[model samples]
Structures are given as C-alpha cells and as structure tokens.
Target: MPTDLVLLNSRLLDPGTGGLLPQTALAAADGRIAALGDDRGIGALAGPGTTVVDLKGAVVVPGFTDGHLHPVSGAERTMGVDLSACKDLASVRAALDAARRSLRPGAWLRGWGLDPNAFGEQPVGFAAVGAVLDGVPAAIDLFDAHSMLASPRALELAGIDGPRRFAQASEIVCDADGRPTGLLLEDAACALVEAVAPVPTEGELLDRTAEVLRTMAAAGLTGGHAMDGMRLGFYAELEERGELALRFRIAPWCQPGADADAVAELVRLQGTGGALWQVAGVKLFMDGTIDNGTAWLERPDCHGESTHAFWPDPQRYTEVVGELHRAGVATATHAIGDAAVRHALDAVEKARTEGGREVRHRIEHIETVPDDTVARFARLGVTASMQPTHCCEFTRADHTDNWSRRLGEERASRAFRCRDLWEAGARVVIGSDWPIAPFPPLTVMAGARHRRPSDLSLPPHGPEQALTPLQALQAYTVNPAWTACEERQAGRLAVGFRADLTVLADNPLNVRDTELRDVPVRLTAVAGRVTHRAPDVS
Candidate 1:
C-alpha cells in the first residue's frame, strides 16, 4: 500500500484519444497511474494518508520522449567550446584565442556548431582557423556535425601528413595546389579526429550523463533514444552505477567487419528483456547529410552529383543491416536522400524475405523521402523516425538557390513531410535530433505546426504537408513510444502506464505560437516521483 498522490484541478491532454478533459484529477500509487477522471471520481479513490497537489490552472500531459538524440555527444559538448553563438570569422578567432589561453597546453580544443555560411563566407581552410589560434591544436565542427575545420596542429597530432586523400564516400575539399583544406568532410575526417581525441573516463561519462538527464528533465523530457556512436560498455557502466535517471533507449553505431559477431556481442550484453538504461538496437549510417551536399539521390540533382560519398562498399551496409535483422536485433539506419532511402527500404525488404518478418526496424531522418517510398514504409512496417526542426531550420535559409537548383522545385516539396507520411500510413515518429536542434517538445511541436521558426515566414517549402499542433504532439509522445515498443507501459496516461507526466505553466493548446519555445515546465514526474519543479515566481 504505497502512499498515493492525487493531482487535482489540472487540464489533461490525452493524445491517445484526442481528448481534452478539464479539472481532471490523476491518482498515482505504486509507480503507476491508479485512477484518472473528473475531480470527484479521483478524489473518492484517494486514501486517507494520500497527498494532494492542486495544479490550479496549469496543464498536465504525458512526459515527452525525444525519439532521437546524442546524449553522450551533447554532454561532452556542454563541457567543450560552444561555437553555436559565433557569427563571423573574427568571433571564431576570438573564441579560439580565449579557449587556448584557458585550456592546458596540447590538450585538444574542440568546438561545435559553426556555420561557414552563417559567417558570410564560402568554406574557409585550416590556415584561417590556424591563424586565429596562433598554432593551437583545435577542431571546430560545422553545424551539421558531418564536417569540421581543423587547425594544422590538430591535423599533425592526428598524424595526417601531407596531401591526405579523402576516403571513398568522403571528401577532403582541397585548394587548387592539392593542399589539404582546413575542412574535413564526411566520416573519414571525422573518424580520424575522433581516433586521436581524448576519450572521457567512465566516471566523467557518467557525470556528463547525469548533467544531460537533469537538463532534459528541466525541458519536460523524461526519456530519449541515445544515438551516439558506440562506446563499448558505456550504458552498462551507467546502469551499474544507477546514475542514469532518464529512460534511455541506446542505439550504438554498428562497427565495420564481423557484422554478425558484433551484433551477437551487443545482444548478449543486452541480457534478457530491456531496461531503462539500455535496449537492443544498432544504428547504421546509409548516406551523408543534406547540409554538406552528401545525401544520396537517384537522379543527380542539377548538381550532377548522384549520391553523397558511399562507404566505399555498399555490401558492408547490407551485411550489417541484414545480420542485425536476422539476429532479432532492431536496426535504425540514417537515410536522408532518396537513393539512400530506397537502398534502406531494399535492405529491409531483403531482411524480411530471408530473415522473416518481426524485425521492427526504422529509417532515421527521411528528410528528403520520395513519393513512391512513402507507401513502401507502411507496407514494410518500417517506422519513419524524423526530426521536425530540420524542416524549419533548412527551409528558412535565405540563399536557397544552391539547394533549390540542386533539388528542383517539385522534388523539394517532398522534404520532411510529417503529415504526408502519416497520411501515407507510415508510423511517423518525431524526434529532436538534439545536439542538431533544440530538444524541447514544445519547440518541436511549434516547428511542425508552423513549418518555420518563430521569426521566419513560412516558405512555400511544404506548408501543405505541415502537421497540426495536436498531431505533432502525438508524434512526439505516442508515436515515439510505439516505435520504441514501449507503448503499453509508457507514452499514455491510462491505468498501469508509467506515472510519467509533465505539468506546464499554461495549456499548450491555448498558448501562443511564439510562446511555445518559452513555455515554462512547472513540474516533471517520473515513476510517480517528482524529479523537477520550477520555483514559484510569485
């Protein structure tokens, strides 16, 4: 007989039934919802020693679940240099100078989220960044995280000596003289830099994980799917320490070579049944990103480029995806372009034919899905896991000539159509892709509803494919839960469901569009225990 707590006088929004009930009371006991109904009905179920919280005029809804986010990368970035605010070369140099002076000598100086285009210039070379750092080793990531600007000292440390050739499916944008430009495009350069960089200790990783969980809880998020590159035994360690607070569905990046062996190891490590800290899933990258002009396309956009750099061998991708499916491990692959999407769909179809159905795999991004592939997702029972903010972020670019010319007007309309996918019968799940965009569910909801940032006007980009506020909310809540296969125990507010809910300062349905980003999360509860609460402003 665990003590019960009754949340009274709150407006409840249930996405499961598309219903809004006012002055509702929700009772929680033994880490599960005991009763939920009108105030009188719920009050009658409350025991004598139960606690009662009057929410007054606030709104209550199921806790948000970010379907995709890089929690580990995000945590590390929080302690590293944040170039997200640097607007120009001068600002970048100034920040580098400041970081170099503050950091230990020869320690890797890393920064993320610098857009060369935003700095009002074409991509610059390493010398540009080197001149600013006065020869300090540094690596500044572009906004897409697909590319980076590395100083000469940093490249030297990575043992990248003279005229480095970009690996297959990777590009090393170079000067006419064949000298390595500061920019490292695609996974080749990224892998080199990562191999040389310092790996955080187990303790440090756990500390960072805790910090990220607190931040997510503050943002009204109680759970997320961590899609960070595989760091062996990372989740196991966190779970052992009991430091992982938020519900995490970790999908480790698949390693090259021995696909079956690697997946077997992952499965054995996962043990029987899933837990809050770890679940069974392997992440694969089928192609490059659109921001860097690497997304794979069937017909070379007007740019004459058919696909972003492929991983040298398409067989490796097929092997990895196929083996995981055969082993009964769920797979989530990143496919942003039409060609990559088709390729991924083909792999899933093959897996189903050979390995039998029941492999509930998913396609990440689907930013530029083609019309023909929409129905294929539903027929194959593949989940379309997408991020809403990318649509607004990319569409708002003023200079769209390059992208528009490459993607043609007709084909561009198919970009990130959440509503269209839903109509096509795809199980559409929304995610923030966090370190790439804000993780606040309210912000994501607004972006989907408006199809543009608050300050930007709706580009005729895909307005007809935009989702309503309620529909967008469902994508963030129930759809993600369904994709994760946790719908019965999570996502909704019915009896026997997890007591995970967020209390907002105002009803989201009544809040202004602009106010969505600023919506204050008054309280957050996980497993029937309040984890976060905003101080009373009055």
Candidate 2:
C-alpha cells in the first residue's frame, strides 16, 4: 500500500547514539512507520492522498510520554483560582477576589497551588483565610496536594467542626484552644473539605480533558501514563469520539480492605482498557509528600517531622502488592521519604518472592533515600518515577526550604537522587507532577539538565544529581514507554513502531543546557496524523 504520510527533509536523531541517522525522511502507512530512508527514497512511496510534511531541516525524535500525572484532576484544577503565583496571604486573597468575579452565583470558591511555605513566619489559619474569603466558602489545596487550607465558610460547609480521628495518618491542624486552623493534611483530612466541593460532571470532565490534552499535544506529548483511573473511560470516550489525541495508560487507585479477590476482580476489569487506553496497574499512596511534614520517614528530622505511613496496616499493603503482581498487574506507589522508599522496595521484593512476576513496579517521587537504596532499584528491577521540577521548584540549595529544613543537612543533600539512581542501573523516568509543577517536558528537561535553583539568587540544589541532556531526553521518551511496557509500540522512531513523532525547532542533544526549554516544538504527530503544527511550520 502507498504511504499515507511522508515526513521529509528532517534530522532523524537516534536517541541511543545521540546522533542523527543518515536517513532523513520517514514514511507512515496505516498509522505505523512504513519506511525510513533519504527524502527521495521515502518520498517516492507517497501516493496522491499522502500528506507530505516539509520539516525544513528540523530535528525529529520520538514523542515524549509523561511517566506520572493526573490528567482529570489537572484539568479541573485549572477551572478555579490558579494561586501558583501567589506568594502571600494578601496576594492569595487578591487572586481569590479576582477568580470569584467569574464564578456563578451560590457556587463555592475553589483554588489550587497554595504554598503555605511562602508565608515565611506568618500563620495559616481559618481566621487568616476567612479574613480574605469573608463569608464565601472556599477550599485551597497546597501545591503538593498533600494538604489544604479551608475558609471558615468552607469548613462549615464541609462540617469539620473539630479535629476527627482517621484510620490512617491525617491531620486537621488546630490551635491551642482546639479551634480549627484551616490546614488539613493527607487525603483523609483533605477529603473532609472535598466531600463538600462540587465534583465535575461527565461532560465537564471530557471537555476539560480535551482542552488540556490539546495543550499537552502542542507541547510535544504524544502520550501519558495517567495516575487517575476512574477517568479512564472518559479518555476512552474521547478517543472513541476522536477528541483524545494522545495515548493513555490509566492506573486507578488501589485502596485498602481489598483482598486477593479484589486483585482478581481488577484483572477482570483490566480487560476494559483498549489500544488508545489501558488499565495497566493500580496506584497506591505509600506515604504523603514531604512538603506538609506528612511523609513517612524512618527517623524524624527537624525539617520533615512525621514518621507515619499512609497505610493503616503495613502487612496488608505488602500482601495486596504481592497479590496484584501475582496476577500480573503493574503497581505504582507514591513514596517520598527514605523509609517509605525502603518499605516499598521490601514489599516489591516480597511480591517477587511469592508471585515471582517480572512486572514493572515503580516508586514515585523518590525525594530522599539512603545511599545503599540507590543500587536496590536496578538490582530489584524497579523504575524511579521522579520529577526534576520538584527539586528546582520546591527544595532549596542552602538546606533552608521546607523540605530541606525537615531533613537537615545530612539527608537533604541526598534529595532527588536522579543521577545516582541511573548510575546504579535503575530505570530513571521523569515527569512534571502537573498542577504541582509545570507540565512542559522541555522545561522539565531544563531542570533535569541544569538543576537550576528556584531562585537564581541561591545556588543550585544537588547539582551533582543533575542528568545529562541525553539521559534527561531518554527519561521523557524511552524510559516512560519502558515503564509502561510499550517500548515496542512507541518511544522510539523505527519501522514497525507507532508513527508518533515530535519535531523540534532545534536539536536538544546538540544545544547548550540552558537553551533546551527555549527550543520550540515545531510539530507533533501521533499515529501518522498531525495533531499540532506551529503556525509558521510550513
């Protein structure tokens, strides 16, 4: 059959060699690569209906895949106040006041990206929040999504009269007199406020997702491993309707109290995931993020004080993990502290011993770890799903930020061990942690490659842990596909693989580290169809 599309006059960069292939054109037929050769050789395969894209000598590489992110939640968060830029209470109030102007009557005020650490010495309390929101009901999530601040009206609406007991580690921070202080830590506590917040409807979810995925496509993301599971069908519906352009692999939350029977049920349910969509695994929170002092740490340091695991029963967690793996389902766990990382590894080891499955299990957000644990990832065949922007946007180089202050100097210096994990032989994959941090892979690559200090005034944090450009590129491209067991279907540009490619204005492999983010994406194609093209791309 004649080729459906011919991408010519481009540099086909080989990720493995960090060099361009001698063949400079690619032919796609039936949504797969048909041929790779010189412009004339591949171009000759193009028939009358074929779309021939003139690349103007741009660099073409495999489309990027985000290792971890919440697609549904990220889209919904954008509907409310984006407090990501707010640095103080007054600014937060100003942002809320501005956001409220666009909201409907009687609707609750909602906001995201609130970082209490910016307050420096100021208190974050209901009184402080109520002063800004006034009588309006409001719920503001912390940047890490591990905690939240609720206005007095919002608390009343959520019926959080006082601190309540939880099955797992959670905190409804209160004052000396037992007055609610507006801070809710961990999912259980955060749920108190969320229980009252309005959930997006099915239509809203699909619409919001379509809007966000387009943004993602233009940024060169050809696919994502979405951490949100219940929304899998939503994306599938979009794919069915041709609205979902990017490929997705969904992992729904695997909660406690489920037994081996539940794993069996999950395996049966997994069949629902199709080509553009898949329910490949379950997502479990082993520990909260370090930002709110909720992370599970072995020994408490002044910087991050909590030593509690999110799971009520560690034995149950291990059993469930083993059960799931035994059934051949992948698992992705959220582990930030060294203790949590160690615990996760132990569980995987236990799973392997019993089930003996070779499924890819990942440890998400490895913010800190013991030196010995670095080699354990590779030895145990674990993937390190890390976010470089977490280090640059949140942690401080001088060990004074919220996270660094919690761990103290000794442990803080070892945070986000990206290079160490890779050098130790672990499959290191990178993601944005979106809404928590920016989602652009190129911008993320800048952080991975440079470890630039959040504040240029300060020194770079853990520059020794920074990744090389090639290593960073692979993290966004090849590593993620491998993590999801889609290496043969996607990740690389080759015959027999899906014709998903990202064209860059400049070759990142040949550019200076600082210039990576600035290099624009000229075009993005998925399955031989052009999803996004720069206005001047022609």
Candidate 3:
C-alpha cells in the first residue's frame, strides 16, 4: 500500500542524538509513520492521491505535550477580560471598563489572569476594585488561580459576607471588623464564590473547548495532561463529535477530605474511557501558591512563618496516595514550597514502598525546594512537572514580585530548578499552565531556556535554573509521554509510533534563545490528520 501522507524537505529532531535525524522526509500510513528517508527519496512511495506536504526546509519534531494545564478552566478564563496584560490596578480597571461596555446589563462581570504583583502594595480585595465594578457581580481569578478579587455584589452572589476558615488553606480575607474584603484564596475559598457563579450550558462549554483546542493545535500542541477533571465530559464530547484536536489524560482533582473510598472510586473509573481522554490520575494540592500566604514554606519568610500543609491532615493525605498507588493510579501534587516539596516526596516514597516505582507520579509547580530534596525526584522515580513561564510571568530576578517578596531572596534564588532536576537524573516535564501563562509551547520553551521577561535589560529570575535547548525539548516531548505512560505509542518518530509531528519554521536547537519564541509553527499533524497548516505550507 502507498503512503497516505508524506512530509518532505524537513529536519527531524531525534531524542537519542538531541539533534536532527539524518533523514529529511517521513512517510505515514494508517496513522503511523511507515518509513523515513532522505528528501525526494520517499516520494516514490506516495500514492497518486497521497496528500504530500512540502515543509520547505522547516524543522519537524514530535508534537509537544502540555504536562500540566487546565484546558476547561483555561478556556473559561480566556472568555472573560484578560487582565493578565494589565501592569497595574488602574490598567486592570481600564481593561475591565473596556470589556464592560460590551457586556449585557446586570451580567456577571468576570476577569481572569489578574496578576497580584501588578497591584504593587495594594491588597487584593474590594478596596482595589469595588469602584470599578460598581454594582456588578464579579469573580476575578488571580494569575496562579490561588486567589481572586470580587466586587461587593459578587460577594453577595457567592453568599459570603464575612471572614471564614476552610479545612484547607483557603482564606476569605476580612477586615478587623470581620467585614468581607472580597479576597478569596486557594480553591477552597474560590469554591465558595464560584459555587453560585454562572454555569455555562453544554453548548457553550463545547464551543469554548473547541476554541481552546484549536488554538493549542495552531500553537503545535498535540496532547496535554488536563489537571482538572470537572469537565472531562467536555473533552469526551469533543472526541465523540470528531472535534477533539488534542489528546488528553484527565487527572480528577483529589482534595484533602477524600478517604480510601474516594480513591477506590477513582480507581474503578481509571480506564473507563480509553485513548483520547482517560482518567489515569488524581491531582492533589500539597500546598497553596507562594504569591499568597497559604504556601507551606520550610521556615519563616520576612512576613513571618506559614509552615502548615494545605492538606489539613497530612498523614491521611499520604495514606490516600498509597491507596491510589496500590490501585495503579497516578497522583500529581501541586507543591510550590520547599516543605510541601519534601512532604510530597515523602508521600511518594510511602506510596512507592507499597506499590513499587513503576507508576509515574509527579509534583507540579515546584517553584521552591531545598537543595537536598532535588535528589529525591530521581531517587523515587518521581516526575517534576513544572511551568517555566511561571518564572517569566510572575517573578523578577531582583526579588520584586509578590512571590519573591513573600519568599525573600534566600529561598527565591533557588526557585524553579529545572536544570538542577534534569541534571539530577529526574524526568522533568514542562507545560504552559495555561490561562496562568501563555499556552504556546514555543513561548513556554523560550521561557524555560531564558527565564526572562521580554525586556533583556531586566535580570532573569533564577538564571541558573534555566534549561538547555535539548533538555527543554525533552521536557516538551518524551518526558511528558513517559509521565502519561504513552511513550510506546507517541513522543517519537519511529515507524510504529503515532504520526504526531509539529513542524516549525526554524530549527529550534539551532535558533537563538530569543528567536525560538517567534519561530512560527508551519504545520501540526496528529495521527496523519492535519490539525493545522500554515498559510504558506504547500
């Protein structure tokens, strides 16, 4: 049988060499790479009706996978006012006001990706945004999704009128008089306000999901490990309707209170759906974000100490992780602080003791960790799931951002040790942490390699933590596939592997670090299907 699709005149990046493959053309048949040969050599295998694409000297590599991102939530967040670009509270209000003109009367005024540091010394509460919101009901998610600011009406809508303590580390900030200040921290607190927030219809959900995935495809992503599972059905519905462009592994969230019974239920539902979208793991929050005061740190910072874990009962959390491991399910913990990192590693070790080390568990957003804990990742065979763009987006090298201000220079210097993790023999995976940062893997890779904001004058935050180009490529490809347990089927250009390839306008390995981000994606193919093709691609 002749090849169904042919990609010609392109360079291929090989994992083994950490460089381009010798061949310049690839043949695909039955949704798998059938053969690889030099340019013009594989043309003989093309059928009369074969769809041949001329890459025109572009670089082709395995389609990038997002190791950690919340597509459902990210999409919903994009729909609201994108306050991520706003540099200050005044700028944020201006963007909100601009968006307000197009909204319906009495409609919920929502915003997302609001940078806490952008407010300078101002507290994240109604005092900073009440006048702008007027009488509108609004829930604005912080850039890290760790906290949010709401208006008075929005607070009323969520039925919160005073300070409250949650089982988790979430806090509904209040004044000395116990009056609600419209600042909600962590998921537990966010849930209180979001519980009564507007719910999108099934149709709206599908549309938004489609929009986000298409954008991801254009940005060269073929898969993602969706961190949240509340909308697994949205991805399922997409595949069912043939609109699902990116494959996903759903990790349903597992908060503190879940017991053995909940773990058992997740185990039962693990492989219910195969391939496109599978529930293979559970997400746990070991600690909260550093920008806020909830993160469980190793010791006291300038603002004093916050050494508590996000999970009220750390022992129970460890026990449940063991249960999940015994059931052959994976667990990904959102551990940002050093204490949280150590505690999560301890939990992984406990699970490994009982279930063995074959399961690929992970710790996400490892923003800050002790130097010693770096050895544990490789020792326990735990994957370090990180977002490079977080450093680029949130912190400055001078310890000026909210996160840096909280940790101080001592701990902040060791933040996001991607290079150290890889050097320590740990499998590291990178992602956009979308809606929190840019979703494009190109931008994410550049951030991983440079760790600087676009301004070259500004010193890069934790420059030593930056990853080499080849290592960053591994994180975006095979490393993530290994974590997803799909290394055998995807993440490579082997004949038996899925025909998932992303073609870039330039060789990523050879390009300048800054130029890499602007390298356009020429084509994106998933299993022999062209999900996206640049206008110039023929």
Candidate 4:
C-alpha cells in the first residue's frame, strides 16, 4: 500500500453538500482520499508511514474547474504579443516596434486583446501599426478575438487582396471609396491571418500547455475545459508526454458544414485520454458577443435596429448538434442573447427527441435570457454554463443599458441569475472564460456575490440575482465538476474522491463579499502531489 498523506487542522468546505466542517483532517493514499473527519481524532488514521501536512489556519476546498476557457488559444496568446495591456495606438506601436526588432525577418507578428473601443475613437488603422513594425507582416486581434486588424504585408501573405478576399460570412471593413481599412470582421479576420499563422509545433504547444497549467494552478484552478478546435493535438501531446500538470476537459470547436469531418476526427482522436485530460464535448457558437453588438436578441433594440444575427441557417446548426448528440457526445453552445439561447435550446430539444438523451448538454454565457426561457432550460435538462465575471466586465463595457433596452426591464433581470437557475431545477456551472476574464476563482466568487465589479461604487446590478458566498463557491467547484461529468470522482473531499484540493489563506465562508477578491491561495494539490505552494505558506 502507498503511504498516506494527511492534512489536518483546517476548515473543510464540501461544495457538493453545501457543508462546512471546522477543524477537519483529510487523509489520502494512492492518489485517492482515504478519510475525512474531525482533526481531533482523525490523526489515528495516519499510520507510521503516513506523511502529515499541517494546513495550520487555512481553509481547504476542492480544486476549481474552469467550466469554459480556450487553453490552446490562451497558450497561443501567451506566446504572442499581448496588446491587451496597450492603452492606445502609441503603445501598440511601441509594442510592435519591440516585437519587430526581436523576431527574424518575415516571421508572423501575432497579438491578442487589442480593443479599438479602449482607444476611444482613435481610428485604429493597420498602416499606423504596420509602420511601427517596419512593414513586417502582422495581425493584432481585438480583445474579443472575434476581429482582427492586419497589415498589408499580412494580407499579401494570406493571399487576401481587394474585395475577393473576405468570405461571405465575414467582412473587410473598407473606407467609403472601397479602400481596405485593415479591419477584418468575424471569419475574415480568423481566415486571413489566424488560420495560416504557423501553428506552433506539437512540442511547443505541449510546453506552453504546461506553462498555462502552472499559471492557472497558481491562481487556484486545478482544471479547465478548453473550447478551441484547432488545438486538439495540444491536449493529446501533453497527455502523451506526461507533462499535463492540471486536469483538463477539452471541448473541440464545431462549425456548420464540417460536422461529419469533425466527428470523424474526434473518433480518430478518442484514444487520447488521460486522468488529467478528457474530451468533454463539442463547442458551438450560436451568436457573437454583446460588446460588439452582435448578440442575437429576440426583438429589435429600442434604437430601432436588431442587435444581432445568426449562423445563416438555424436548421444547419440543429443538424450539426443532432449529429454530435447521435454520436453520444456532449454539446456546449455559446448563447448570449435571448434569440440565440432559444435557438440553442431548440436544437438541443430536437437532438434529444431524435437521438434520446446521453449527456447533459450545456448553453454557455446566458447573458440575457428571457423570462419565459428560464423553465425551458430545466425542461430540456440542459446545463446553464455561465461566467459571473461577464456581468462585471459588461458593466465596465457600458452595455447593460443595451441589454435593458433590448430585453425589456423585467426580461433583463434573468441575466446571470445563478440562484434563479438553481431554483428552477437547472444545473448552473461557473467558469472564468479566461483571456476574456480573469482566472482567479476568488474574483469570480466576488463577482457572483456582489454582481458588480469591485471598483464600482454603484449598487449591485441585480441584488436578487446575487448568490450567497456558499452558493458562489459551489458554482466554482461542485457545479463545474458536475458539468464536466467528474462530480463523483472529484469536486469533494470524500473518502473515495480524488485528492485534488486547494488551501486558501482565509476561509471563504467568513470572508466579506469585498474581501473575497483579496483572498490568496495558500497551496494547491492534485492527487496527493502538491502542485503550487505560496511562498509564505507551507
């Protein structure tokens, strides 16, 4: 038998049952928890061969699982220039100049998180950014990753020229006279630059995956679900190399017209499974984000214009979702507006009726759900996978008014209603959607509790929607584990559960809503092996 590891003298939070036990000791042996009870008497379970870890004045909770994040995209963004930190065109130019001098000639200059709105009417043209790069081919993605601004050199490299370049679903925004304005929207941006940008070698991707896992682990996240399609091999390679440090649930990207091809590919890659990594499901996008005014709202906005659109054919989306469902795979659809959410629910209902139930399909980002649609989620047995940070970030984006005007005052109350979802008998899971939001679970917890950004002095967006600290913790822990289909084996400190846990500097149960964001992670462990330990703790 393997030697047991014991953690004692700590507050144990069981998100699964919404229970907190004071002064508990948990024992793990052979990568599984062996015992959990009051610390006063549980020490006897630690044999002579056991290694004891005194958690000493800390709170221990299950390892966090980020229900939605693009690990491959996150890693790629990490390797590229981070335009997210740039304040304006001048800063963008400065960063480009630095990247230009550092790279070899003709190398692709890539960047992520460049918001034109952040610059406030500065008219971000590729020429200005291109001049700073000394004419090297370059592409800088907007903060949303839904758009890109590329230089002429980049356009030439990608074989995009004049009006023939952009696809039907995409647009190359040009000046009134039809001159290229350097901005590529939707598929045009992804197709022209990101598609052809040299994919990192398998080894490079694996290394970066390790780095990303470490970074996330340090932030108190033990696992995450990657929602990008292009980087499937990254997860496979990490598991093959035995370098994956954190648990991962991968949801490969899905698109119209490619359902058969994607399903076949997934079948081929099905052998790549790990205790730390698994193909959670397929990811589909029903509509674009609200920040870009592309969420498919039900009714036209008060401004007398529709704020959204769909994927050309609603039936095609339903067909693809059905195919994946028939194959016994789970599905996660991104739906921010009422129309998009309804469309996704309709597809899932059709798929469920045709193929019969298999796994819990989920709708990610229910930003503006309609009043009538709340019961539909529970009726169809679909999971509401949401990101609480979105409420705060969207508030900062100043789009709440748009939602209110489009969805009506009463309908708008359903946004990010974690409590309401639970009340309606719908499973609600939380995620950071990192690279779009911060990864710290504490930040997410605080956002859920306050329903507003910490810096905002205004009253909480919807006080009725706010989750108690205990409820917020479950959203981050047990709820995500259930969504990932790992609740039984993980998400709790039970006798037979996996020994994945995080120790915090302060007990979240006692911490004030505002103080939640300030709480630091003391240590993080996976399967009895310590992965991260804060410098001053342990």
TM-score-based ranking, best first? 3, 2, 1, 4
Error of 1 at 321 (Å): 2.7
lDDT of candidate 3 over 1-538, digit per residue (tens): 6677899988888864677788999998887899999867788889897889988899889888999999987787777788888888789889888887877988987788888887789877778864778888888888887888888888888889887778887788898999988888888888887888887777987898898899999999988988988877787788888788987888888888886677777788787664467887989988887877888888866677467899999898899888888878889998989998999999889888877656888999899887799989999989999998888878888888888888988888888999999999999999988878888998898899999875454678888888988888889998998888888988888887888889999878888887788899999987777889999889
lDDT of 2: 0.84
The deviation in Å at residue 40 for candidate 1 is 5.7
Clashes of each: 2, 3, 0, 0
TM-score of each: 0.90, 0.96, 0.97, 0.88
Query: After superposition, which runs of candidate 2 have C-alpha atoms over 4 Å from their true positions?
Result: 101-105, 453-458
lDDT agreement of model 3 with the native: 0.85
Q: What digit string (tens of lDDT, one per residue) describes model 1 on residues 1-538?
A: 4446788888888877667764388989886888788888887777787766778767888888888888877776656687766656778778878888888877878888775545444555665654666567777787677787777777777776555555456666667777677678777766786788876786787788777777788888877877874553555666566655567777877644444667677666543333456655878887776666777887777656646526557677786777778878888888888889988899898888898758789999987777798879999989999887877765543336344546777667677878888888988888788787777878888777777764555553577777776777788788878887788988787888888888888877667665677889987877776767777721
Candidates 2 and 4, the one with greater TM-score: 2
Off-target runs (Cα >4 Å) in candidate 1 are 38-52, 87-90, 104-107, 119-121, 127-130, 163-168, 229-243, 270-275, 301-309, 397-410, 454-460
Q: After superposition, how far is residue 101 of candidate 1 from its true place, in Å?
A: 4.5
* Candidate 4 C-alpha error for residue 166, in Å: 6.8
List the global CA lDDT of all models: 0.75, 0.84, 0.85, 0.75
Question: 1 or 3: which has the higher TM-score?
Answer: 3
Distance (Å) between predicted and true CA of 302, model 4?
Answer: 8.4
Window of ten residues with lowest summed lDDT in model 2: 451-460
